[model samples]
Target: MLKWIAVAAGVLLLAAGMVPLAIIWIESRQARQAGGMEPHVASAQPARRGAVVVYFSRSGNTALAARHIANRLDADLHALEVPEYALGLRGLAHSALDADARRNDPARLRGIRPRTLDLRPFDTVWLGSPVWFYSPAPPIWAFVEHNRFDGQRVVLFNTYNSNIGDDQIAAFKARVMARGAASFEHRALLRGRMTRQIGPDEMLRRIDADWLAGDAVRAPLTARTPAPAAP
Candidate 1:
């Protein structure tokens, strides 16, 4: 009887372990298949003005959105890098722990290298990050803390797996606004199974519509230029 009980316990543990692995496999397979699609290219001409996209992506979901936005606007793109972590699931877990520590104790967070960014030329800045435990990723905090956005229009974009990302977006907005950014706006994308439910083109259309509408708070009259006529 004891032997049978032990066998049953072992089987349950094995099944528990296999569940997460199966989920990971399915998500990865779907991502690879979706990767073959040619991303929608924005036909509209880029704004004839200074704009830039800066982002940190872990699973590449945020990177895809960043690329789409940058391509649509024809803006300069910058990818934030950290030396401590590698890419993939292991790196994601490592970064999440790091972000949690930073949230609890801000002083524990370290600054990123390759620190030089000249924000002077750009009037508009698009900041992107993947959500980490209801907070912006650690690298994002490092970058935003070290930079000044005075007199700039700042837009926040985030990618998340399950959560709606309200807390993450709010936290990010408060930080950048405190740094003297002139205006703040945001957009969030749901990834994984949620994305598969909505379809990729729907996501693209939402992003494009938000961009065309200038969804953020109004920029100062001087900073606002009329968008170029669509070709």
Candidate 2:
């Protein structure tokens, strides 16, 4: 009887895992359909210590991190938006589908805010986003693709529940470098799962200790931390 119970448990676990995989496949097909997804353009300008922190957040983790960086650096802050990915389960489904779809086509972003990014003024650009489907969110990719980072330092940052794989990091780094960024670096923090989530104060403390040491490197941060699950 115990052996039979163990077999059933294993089958249940496998079924649970397959459910999401099936959902992802279905979402991918839908995303590929016409009127499924679209892209948007950002506005641009020039200006003259100058830095900017731009990010997109679904659960506010990345947004909080962005605010902390902006305050610490006295840099300008801009938020990216995707109306389709609003705050709910449906929104989350859309986000997951978009991330999955991006693995192939990398669709242009639609309904994202601040249509333009003026890289001329800022010497350093900090791009922040939450990791989705083990990758940088689609909006971030669209923003990066639409802009040129010539002669400026580009730093990528993320707030995640689990980990951003090395391959994703390497790919993002290559993309930024290809865009003519003078330099590139990354920083990330693990906030744990939603139940035992890390608070804003503690998260900032980790950021200070790990990334924002002083005026010297006053630039960027993102990485992987062992955690219960994903965000």
Candidate 3:
């Protein structure tokens, strides 16, 4: 009797593991059929005061947000393609493990398109990524770690199904600001539960100027002139 119970528990565990794999397979297949993850740039328009959108998307959720942002800002768009996070069980496992390990090493990001970008020309820059492990994905961290945004307004956006803690947000904001960004702001889209989540259209609708431009954190004033010896 004990042997039978043990066998049943083992079978149940195996089934549980397969369920997620199957779901990942179906979603990955659907995404591929729907024209795999691609960096989308809006119709060519004059960059809004020299703006650009750079983003890292794993399963296209963040890509959608990036596309809308580029359109809203009339800016050029670029996607960071982390080969290590390509669609598949292996890739999914890699992403989760890396994030779980909190590995923000820039070397983990490779083979991304437009290998080098000059951020100096852009007065405003938008960065987007999906929330992984309740934080911005490691590739986003890798990008920020490798680059600086001197004197430019930097905006960070995220698409998350679950909650993003304030601690993570604070840390990421501090890191971006450390890169010499003139200002920083963060925006997030919460899709809620899978059964009642907002669709892509609604998500896009929410990406307006008010949503993007709100809650800005400007760099602290430096070298404030002293009063004339208090008169």
* lDDT (tens digit, per residue) of candidate 1 on 37-89: 44533334345546778888655566667777776565677888876644545
Task: State residue 12's C-alpha deviation in candidate 3, in Å.
Answer: 3.3
- Which should have the higher lDDT, number 1 or number 2? 2
Q: Would you list the clashing residue pairs of candidate 3?
A: none
Model 3 clashes, total count: 0
Models sorted by lDDT, best on top? 2, 3, 1
Residue 121, candidate 1: C-alpha displacement in angstroms:
0.7
Which is the better candidate, 2 or 3, if ranked by TM-score?
Answer: 3
Query: What value of lDDT does candidate 2 attain over all alpha carbons?
Result: 0.74
User: Which candidate leads in lDDT?
Assistant: 2
Give me the displacement of residue 134 in model 2, in angstroms: 1.1
Each model's TM-score?
0.73, 0.72, 0.78
Model 3, range 127-200, lDDT digits (tens) per residue? 89888778888878778877889999888889887888777888888888999998988888897653466766
* Index of the highest-TM-score prediction: 3
lDDT of 2 by residue, 130-158 (tens): 89878889888878887889999888999
What is each predicted model's overall lDDT from 0 to 1? 0.69, 0.74, 0.72
